[model samples]
Target: MIGIADYLDKQLRDYGIKEDLSILDFGCGQGNYTIPIAQIVGGNGKVYVIDKDKTKLNQLLVIAKKVKVDKTIEILESEGQFDFDLSSESVDLVMLFNVSCCIIGQDNYPEFQKLIHELHRLTKKDGKLIIGIKEGKTMLNRVETGIPLISKEFKLDKKEKGKYLDGEKLRNGIFYSLTKK
Candidate 1:
């Protein structure tokens, strides 16, 4: 199994995110990536972790406290949608790892467009947004459809596929690094 801390460092190195960069992990499940990022960012930087489920947040809090990493992660219990609940243009990076489908639901319907718009709203100018998901027809097709929605508000900086971290292959999943123009 890939350790969360190692995975976080590898991903950051791969993506070229440096120290002092603030990040938001949308749908961060139970501090899997959150704890590692907290350590990676050090005391100077911050990580905002948002999830729709309160139980998961509580569990993450416990893990953070037990591991002495609670101070680095800001746990936000998303009450409405997967909204960040932070000030506009505040974050440096928004990480949507395996979260797009969960937020939009797996129904393969049309409501996902709104989620795409919301992602655009939360990102800052020049801020990078990274999204990762499994290989699936629905996810692949949704990315194709959602690209147009995001393009309306931001410009794509880079698009990559088959990127792997900690023995995990991103496969059909795509990570779109977009900047608000």
Candidate 2:
């Protein structure tokens, strides 16, 4: 059984994540991507993990400690809003994996737009924003509809379609690599 961290590592490498670059894992849940990202970034780089759930952040810290990469991971607790306290152009990579659709769903378009703008501000010039959405009817619909809005703030670099085994299920998804323009 492949773990989610391993799956995320493969996807990130496929999307061109390099070493010694600061990263931000927005909506990071339980450090799935955070740990791998920290490993990729090494000691010189940093991976900022942000999520609204404190419990999850704590779990991420423990995992980081267990992995002996806690120094490379910074945990931040969000207020369930797009308002982040980080400086502009502070990070080289920002990941919005499997969470953007929830922000842009039927009742959250405004929040989604706000997050897009905020992400743009947080990303360094030429930095990358990678968005991954699970390939499901509802999620696909939301991503397609939201792409236009997202394009206003980011230039779509490229996209890749793929699948990964998640426990007993094969989860199909698309990875959108967008650049700050």
lDDT to native, each model: 0.70, 0.82
**Each model's TM-score?**
0.80, 0.90
Question: Which RMSD does model 1 reach against the true structure?
Answer: 3.4
Clashing pairs in 1: none
lDDT of 2 by residue, 22-76 (tens): 9999988777677888898899999988899888898989989998999998865
Q: Kindly give the number of clashing pairs for every candidate.
A: 0, 0
- Against the correct fold, how does model 2 do in TM-score? 0.90
